[model samples]
Target: MENAENLLHKGVIEGEEGALNQFYYGYEANDPPEKQLSPPLKSKITGISLKRGQRVRLETPGGGGFGKSSERPLEKLNYDLEQGYVTETKDD
Candidate 1:
């Protein structure tokens, strides 16, 4: 048992919330076996236990952007799209 807090950070700008970390466990049988999933836990998690065949996965969130999206340069944004790091949308 352990106490983990502030698992996620807040975004600097408005409408920009940092991604929440995720924890997954268990197994499911399918064409390709898949791990059973659980919702992101934004707060503290305690008293977790695991069995012999069970597993746990921890997905950490990416860092928050520094400033406004509109302030980003077009060239860099274009490159992100070209390289599949970002996707183009009607809003842009």
Candidate 2:
């Protein structure tokens, strides 16, 4: 579905080495699913199969803001940019 977390085992399959059969990555923020009325839905995945000799790269989805993005402090937002947590256009 839309906005779903990405795959954890997204990497190149290289020489003879076994990859992880299971995926354990971070998740997006628990924002309300619709209309900002109900609580966030639970996010989970059953399992995944990996091939041998696969190079694995693990990454977690960054969570969204709890409230309006504008409500976030400029200092913190700038910090995020400085630390490469996120990027924004000059206009933003």
Q: What is the TM-score of each candidate against the true structure?
A: 0.43, 0.33
- lDDT of candidate 2 over 1-92, digit per residue (tens): 43334323322233122122233323224533332222222354444444453333343453333444455699998998899865686332
Model 2 off-target regions past 4 Å? 1-56, 89-92
Count of residue pairs whose backbone atoms collide, per candidate: 0, 2
Which segments of candidate 1 are over 4 A away from where they belong?
Answer: 1-8, 13-15, 28-35, 39-56, 78-92
Deviation (Å) of 10 in candidate 2: 23
At residue 70, candidate 2 shows an lDDT of 53
The number of clashing residue pairs in model 1 is 0
Clashing pairs in 1: none
List model 1 lDDT by residue over 16-37, tens digit each: 4445566776543332335465
Q: Which one is best on TM-score?
A: 1
